[model samples]
Target: MWKFTLRRILIMIPQIILLSILIFILAKMMPGDALTGMIDPNVSPERLEELREKLGWNDPWHIQYADWVGGLVQGDFGQSFRFKMPVTELIGERIVNSFWLSVATLIFTYLIAIPLGILSGRYNDSLLDQTITGYTYLGFATPLFIFALVMLWVFGFMLGWFPTSGSVSPGSEPGTFAYVMSKINHLILPAIAMALIATVNTVQYLRSEIIDTKQKDFILTARAKGASESRVYNRHILRNSLLPIAAFFGYEITFLIGGTIFVETIYNYPGMGLLFFESITLRDYSVVTAVVLLFGVAAILGALLSDIILSLVDPRIRIK
Candidate 1:
């Protein structure tokens, strides 16, 4: 297991490096540079050139990339042209908001998906199964941003049950119960948007896997041995069935991060997604590159974690 884990971690290094190269290239190839967006139309050409030089736009692409990567290694993510702050600081604040939203969405998704999937699988071809299937299709068909907007209208505008946007209510003291409750209220629309988007697909995938496992020879043997139905399903089938779902978890996390961009924007939640969006609109290359690299590293780590989890769950996967 140690050897497997070490190998997975080693593999992530090259993946992160390659992702950095791609992001750097894409940022450079964009139609404008940071200076282009920063300069006023009436600014003299000489002043614009001075600003460009100050921002290192005068350097060769390779030189700039090397400096950027070097700074990255030293934990200096540079400054955001738009926000006039260190990219790291901006991202750090947003990370908390994004983390809460993602964690809540994850918990909600699994809570609603796993048990419902298990039940649907156990009662396959029944009315309950069909109903779940229908709901899953509906979820799959709907666009997440649209769902967020509609939810905002119903829950925020019409019912006035939750705040329309933002991470907390204005003037709410931080770290108090009131502040926490305000955060939760702000999270409701986006969380529901994320949950409704994820639950259907995850439940359907789990349902299929569980159903397949239930029909396996080992499951039949367990049943024939006079095991209780719950025991057979939970102890035997669920354990084996989780392998595929576990493998997919890492990919799903990355997808959730990307999906959060749209949902966060729609709900006006201050998160990495919103920051990334603002960075791009303002041509804040440093912020863009840092956020992309951060997300890439997250994806690589997630994959490594998934591999370790799979090995822990089933010893057969351990490296020799």
Candidate 2:
């Protein structure tokens, strides 16, 4: 397992390099001068030219790329013109909120999705199974923004059960139970909206796994030994069915992080998603690149964690 993990991490080096290059290309494709993103808007041409000279803007493309990568290695993301602050500092603050929201969203996603999947699969074509199937399709079909809007309207305004936007109420007191509840309350609506959308894949995937595993020879052997239905389910069928779900978690995690951006935007929540959207609209290239890099890193880490989890749960996977 250790060897496999080390190999995977080693493999990630080239992927991260490729990701950085892709980000650089995308940033370069944006309209306007890169120098504009690094300077104050009201600066005179003289100052701009001075900065251009100082930063070696006249250097060859490869030299410039090397400089940028070197700066990145040293944790020196350029200043955000819009925020008037270091891009890393801005991302550092926002990423925490995104992390917590993602945690809440995944908690809701798996807790709700797993049970529905098992029930639907166990019951096969019964009414309960059909109902879950229909709902999963609805989730897959409904646009995220539309669903978020309706959730805001119905749950936020009509029922007044959740705060419509933001990470917490304006006056929320830190280090208090009320503050904690406020945070959780703010997360609930958006988390559920994202969860419902996220759960479709898990539910369908797990459901299919359960059904397929149920017909296997191993499952039959377990039953023939007079293993109780509950015992066979817990030990044989469900355990086997779960391996695929565990393996698929990396893809699900990447989707959740990416999808959270729109949900955060709609809710006006302070997170990487919202920050990424705002930075792009404001054309804050430094902040945009930082957020994109963090996102890529998050995706890579999520995949690595998924593999680790799969290996822990099934030794055969690690051995292979």
Candidate 3:
């Protein structure tokens, strides 16, 4: 297990480098310089040139990449051109808020998906299975933003059961029970929105896994041994069936990251998703690069997490 984990960690090094280079190239391809949004519109050409020189914008891309990587190693993510603050400080709190939303979404996703999957898979061809299938199709057809707005409108505008915007309510002192409750209350709607968007594939994956695992020779053998159906499924089938779902979480991570941009924007929630949208609009390249890099790193780590989980569930993975 240690060897496998170490190898995977080692593999990430080159992936990160390549990902960085790709982002840099893409950033370079944008029409204007980062300085475009940093100054007054009427600034003189000479002033813009001077500012460009000061920021080493004229430097070779390789040199700039080196500087950026060096800064990353030293914990300096550069300054936000628009905000004029350290990138880390600008995004630190927002990342936490995003983390809360992402975690909540994933939790709810599994909570809803796993049970439905088990039920539909366990009782295949029944009314419940048909209902779950219909729900998945409906969920797959609805756009995430549409679902979010419906949730916002029905729950936020008409019903008045949940707050539609923001991660916390005003005048709730941080760290208090009221503040915590406010956060959760504000969280429920958006989290559910993203979770429903996230749950579709998980449900399908686990359902298929359960169905396939049920027919495996081992499951048949267990049943042949006169084990009760419950024992056969509980002790053997479920354990083997969940392995694929564990691996599927990698896709979930990327999905949630992408979904958050839409969800956060709709909810007006303060998080990296909204930040990414705002930064792109403002052409705040420093924040953009940071957020994109964070997202890429998340994807890479998510793959690693899947491997780790696979190792945990299937001892053969660790033994090899």
Q: Global lDDT of each model? A: 0.85, 0.86, 0.88
Greater-lDDT candidate between 1 and 3: 3
> Per-residue lDDT tens digits of candidate 1, residues 1-320?
78888888887888888899999999998888677754467888789899889878779988999999999889899988778889888999999999999888887887888888887887989999999999899988998888889999999999999898899999999989999999998987788778877888778988898889988999999999999998997798888776667766776678677878898888889999988888888888889989888888887887787778878877788778
TM-score of 3: 0.93
Return the top candidate by lDDT: 3
List the lowest-lDDT window of 10 residues for candidate 1. 32-41
In the range 1-320, model 2's lDDT, one tens digit per residue, is 89988888998889999998889778767885545655456888788889778867667766877888888989998878788888878888888888888888888999999999999989999999999999999998999889988998999999999998899888879999999999999999999989989999999999998999999999999899999999988998898888778877777779877788889999999998999999887777778887888789889988888888788777777744
Q: Against the true structure, candidate 1 has what lDDT?
A: 0.85
**RMSD after CA superposition, every candidate:** 1.8, 2.6, 2.0
Error of 2 at 295 (Å): 0.6
Ranking by TM-score: 1, 3, 2
What lDDT does candidate 2 reach at residue 272?
A: 89
Pairs with steric clashes in candidate 2: none
In model 2, where do residues sit more than 4 Å from their true spots? 33-58, 311-320
* Residue 30 of model 3, lDDT score: 80
